[model samples]
Target chain A: MATALTRLPDERLAELLHGYRASSAGPRRRALLLALTIAFLVAVAAQVAEVDLPRLWEHAGAFFGYFDRITMLESGAGRVWADPAEWFWGWRKWGVLLLDTLLIAYVGTALGGLGGFLLAFCASANLVSNPWARGAARRFLEFCRTVPDIVFALIFVIAFGLGPVPGVLAIAIHSMGALGKLFSEVVENIDMKPVEGANAAGASWPAMVRFAVLPQVLANFISYALLRFEINVRQASVLGFVGAGGIGQDLIEAIRKFYYNDVAALLLLIIVTVMLIDLGTERLRHRLIGALESRA
Target chain B: MNRAVTLRDAAVAEMAGIAARHPQQFRAMPPARLRALALFLASTGLLVFGLWRLEFSPSRLVDGFGQLVHFLGLMIPPDPGTWSRTMLILRGLSETLAIALLGTLGAALLAFPLGFLAAWNTSVNRLVQFLSRRVLDSVRGIDALIWALIWVSVVGLGPFAGVLAILTSDIGTFGKLYSEAIEAADRKAVEGVTASGGGKLHGIRFGVLPAVLPVMAGHVLYMFESNTRSSTIIGIVGAGGIGLMLSEMIRTLEWGVVSFIVLLILVTVAVIDTISGRLRAALAGARAG
Candidate 1:
């Protein structure tokens, strides 16, 4: 390759080198431009958001200091484990509230999963021939998803008079939107052969869906629902801050009232619970997919 | 031998007849049939019991739903209130956007190095990788709202607190996601670079980064979209944003302002969604080409 390049005519070699230089320089120039643009955006955003470097520098210690305070032993106390009873004094109450949070997520996911399952068929363009119906379904799901679950909780809290019911309903609506979108996508990508077979046999729409679509999408639907459940658990805790009822009520109170140790304890419980749920659901989803694949 | 052959023929005929008569029933039961049935029943029971515990009465739902309809009716012709109030809301909206953008940028910057450390293939040591992974998981386990609450106390109320909250949460998320992207990167380029006597860092710079940059950019843009929603929520917790205005309006029963604010949020989110969607698509197309 080097000998062939050296034997080329001077003009041809000059042209080749020029092309090589331009090709290399092109990306470098583009990278520089992109970097400058991003830097400018960041600077403006920092100004608008009031993210002062000096302020952060001055207050950085306080952030760590707060965590230090949360971990500090109470006056006259020895260590974290020395007074387990004192540290976890509110454990029983917090445990109940945590359970309430989990239950709320469970019911909400189930209800929303059911709702999404029912709506997914209509929402899928491949399954639903009527463009109008599909469009309407898609729009409704979009609206449901566009509004944050917290906002829905606020509305429901007022209507339901502040309890887990509002939280459940809010989660259900949001999850329906989320799961419906996912389920429809799964439906759209399924094997068309079974659907065609069912249709050719003069099967009804419901029968065709049951025989063709459900069998294919059930595993995916369940996996998505499980993931939604994991997310909903976190949301449920946050909903409690809006008076929807859960451990978050206690958590926000602890923060507001500066119950430092209680805050730490509650955060620990929440973190541990969420992690456990995440692990369990991950295992379950894997098992579910494995079974489905093996069966297939 | 002839008698045995006759017996086998008779058995085969009997099986075919049964299968022809009951095609569906002839299929063997799935191994998971019993487990699936039990799971369904248990799940249904749990749902029912949970509904009861939560006091989800049908009559109550009907009654509350009626009130909700009335409440929604009052939301029509969403009022922007006085010009002064409108200005405040617009300012708040801008603050929310700034918070999201800055927070996402900060998180991405901070997570970049941490992601390399956390990636199994890139880490300097197994211990560092393990520790970084755990740190990411634990930090991410805590919700952004909780972080906001902590920051509000640490930095006092304002968009600064919201930005910090978003930054902290996104650091955990981006660290995990970016590391996964790096680990999934194609290794052939790295191998070629090494074969040419390139240093480890050079291999990463030329090989891994090129493969992962588009994906990382896509993830960051997606984070910005999500952080916008999160910033609004954190604002309600006194972290300072449009959410504070929203909560205040709701508390005062300012249905008009509440509806107006909700509409503003919805429109802003939709706009961001569209822009980010296009940008991500472009990135993906670029990667493909």
Candidate 2:
């Protein structure tokens, strides 16, 4: 094959060789480019973020030391398991706070889910004919979701005083925005045949939405709300740090006071609660979707 | 012929009578409707009870709204403080970005192997996969703020602590997401590699990794955007970032400065959102092309 190619023509051989080289070198060249870009980005990020290797090395021991302390029993105590009572000494108060956190999430999700349901139809471009109304609803939701719930909690804490009430409102507003967007997207993707049928029957916009759009998007809306609830639970826990009320306040206090065992205990409780919520919601969401599908 | 006509007439009359008797049957609510109605009523009751328990009275809400408006009024004409203060804010903003970038990158790098191990298809052992998944869940259950508080104690108060906080929390999240992505990868490519006499590792490297990289990169970019928000908030707990400044200003009731920082954050986040959106689209386009 080589002798035949050489016999054909010199220019043709050069062209074939160039074509083979180009094909072979394409991936290698792309890989090299990618690697170089990554290297440059990493170097810049390291400098800007102040990721000092020497400092990290020095503090590595201290980092593990803190974990060791958290796990350690009291000064004279033996193993952590031996002092179960001491470990979970503040269980009652923390438990109450955790319950409060869950309640906050529930109320917030309900309120937000309601708001989302109300606004989603108006926001959905496929449903709402008026450009202005759709734009307004979309912008409102964007503003709601854009500002972090923590900031909302901060503001509400100022207005409503330091309690779970502020946390509830904050979560509600943020969830409304998040769920609204999702719900609208669901509405937008619905089969328009039912909507057209409703319209043909001389149904008003609200009636059309109620009779047609709601049925189609209800399953998806619920699913998104459940997912948001999962997120709001996590958010509610942290809201307590800002005095909005939850177990987070206790967790932060334990850390600041050097209550190492309490910190560990509180963390475990929070982690367990969150995990349970996650699992429970996942199951509930799946079941709800399945039921909806079966019904449809 | 007369008998047949009478029989047909009788049958038509009987059908009409049945339809008239059960006129609403076709449009009637299903048997499950009752259960759905009960569930809705029960949920509404629960929601009302929760509101009452939380003391979320309408009057109180109205009153709070007034207060909120007053506070918002105070936030008008956001002041950037002095030039030095402006510089300080800029520096904090930069730190927040850096923290997000480095934390996300670190998490993606660390989670890659763990994700492979956690993936059901790729895991060497079922027990190992189960344990890895549980660990990710437990760790991820703790929010980044909590992680920040822990790291602050561990590494002392600084942006380093902030970075560590984001790193640890993101590791759990990225691990779970990456593993899911890995698990969802098409097996045909892997089978092809194996059919070509490649080993398992070679199959994964040449087949699985290529399929999942784009998805993983997308996740990483998204995480970077979110981590920016997280890094800001972690600072409020004193791990060190713009959040520390924000909380401090809020404590002093410096509404103007607080407003300024809030706007700064909003703008930064918006810009990041655009950039990440474009990058993702580009990446998707490249993959498709």
Candidate 3:
């Protein structure tokens, strides 16, 4: 085959390869127009966003400069790794707050996931016969998710007087909105055979849902909840910035006070915690989804 | 005929044999169900414990709910305060949109090259891919809010810091996502380019990019949608965006104004979602190549 292909002229081979991608000019024009539109929007964005190219060029060093400083130890011992003990002088306090962050995420995800699971049935068009009920549920979930969890945290901190309570509530509300939407979508796409079977058997609405829908959607619900849990952990870490509780308070303080080493340590801790949660949740989700797939 | 006197006897014998062989299966529930029950109970217990530790007692929760309800009551008939304040909110919202747009664009532009470095198929070597992927992963682990806070210290504040923050975190995300798309691109195109005596850059330009650009564009559109949300919150950290107006209103006990800003955000979000959804659909459906 190679000898046969080599027998062809160089010009012929080039033509064959080039012709493979030959097309009309219409798409190229469309793509060019798209590019021009994006470029125009970007120009307007630069003006509105106050993106001064010269300013950015001048102060860009400070960007990397901050990272450089954060890596340095408080004792002037080069980097954090050089003198790990001094760099992590406040690890004990941070560790406790880290635990608080984790707990807050745990409670938030649980409450949120539970709330979503229950409300999803109402929101799902296929499950709830009442249009008003489905619309109300859908709108509530949309409102919950639309409002940022941190914004909720800010308000709750004010109303509840600053603690993990506000943080958990914030996460829970946001998660419920997000997970509710996902769960309802999952329910809408389920096979209707079992549902019809149960209906024909004269099962009541609740019984039909319990027997037909729950089995089909339970694994998906758990998987979505686990994904939400991973996100909640990240949010929980930052809730303290609003005094809603967790390590975020200290983190903000460190950033504000120019405690570079401390900032570095806290960020590392937060990232590591989030990464760990992500890994665990990912594994659980895979197993749940994999088992469901195998079962089917 | 002599052995089986009736169908009922044969059925009973078969049932007994099956039950004896798989007794657990004959039980009311499977082992999997029991395990699921256990897992549920364990997680519930943990949640309860965590809530307790967070000081979420029933009384406190009730009290908190009451206060929140009162706050809601205070928010009745949303007010925009003075016309000037309303203008300020509008300006802030516009600024937030701009920040998201610029930051996302910047991140995409910057990440395009780094993506080639990180992708297993396009990198110069294994070491480069490994290092680039790890670097991207570490940077992405830090949320955009944290980046905003950090950038505030660097650039002192304003939309510049906010954009930088968004740009920083998004570069990590976009690079990783872009590289993944690159990896998923069909290799046959690249081989065809190579067979035609195309250079490395030529292969990537003519072979890989055409396949992955639309996918990357879809990802970029999604990123822009999410970044708009991030821009709002980053402003709360003292960067330039509508979040500063939001936090200010909330802190000053201006419930009406807070509700108004929130309503504005909700409307803006809905609008952006609709537009982005359409663009994404167009991108996916169009055969630009």
TM-score of each: 0.92, 0.90, 0.92
Which residue window of length 10 is worst by lDDT in model 1 chain B? B25-34
Please give, for residues A119-231, the per-residue lDDT of candidate 3 as tens digits: 99999988788999999999999999999999999999888888889999999999999999999999999999999999999999999999999999988888888888888
Where does candidate 2 clash, by residue pair? none
What TM-score does model 2 score on chain A?
A: 0.90
**Would you list the rank order by DockQ, best first?**
3, 1, 2
Q: Each model's DockQ?
A: 0.65, 0.56, 0.68
Residue A237 Cα positional deviation in candidate 3, in Å, after optimal superposition: 1.1
* Residue runs of model 2 more than 4 Å from their true location after superposition: A1-21, A24-27, B1-30
Model 1 TM-score relative to the real fold: 0.92
Q: What would the per-residue lDDT of candidate 3 be over residues B1-289, giving only the tens digit for each residue?
A: 6665777777787997879898988999898889989998998889878877888788887888999999999998799989999999998998899899988999999999999999999999999999998889778888889999877776777888889889999999999999999999999999999999999999999999989988999999999999988899899998799999999999998999999999999999999999999999988888463
lDDT of 2 at A27: 83
Candidate 1 residue B274 C-alpha distance from true site, Å? 1.5
Per-residue CA lDDT of candidate 1, range B72-135, in tens? 8888879988999999999889889999998899999999999999999888899999999999
Taking all chains together, the TM-score of candidate 2 against the true structure is 0.90
Candidate 1 vs candidate 2, TM-score winner: 1
- Evaluated against the true structure, the overall lDDT of model 2 is 0.87
Task: Tell me which residue pairs clash in candidate 3.
Answer: none
Each candidate's chain B TM-score? 0.89, 0.89, 0.92
Off by over 4 Å in 1: A1-20, A76-79, B1-31
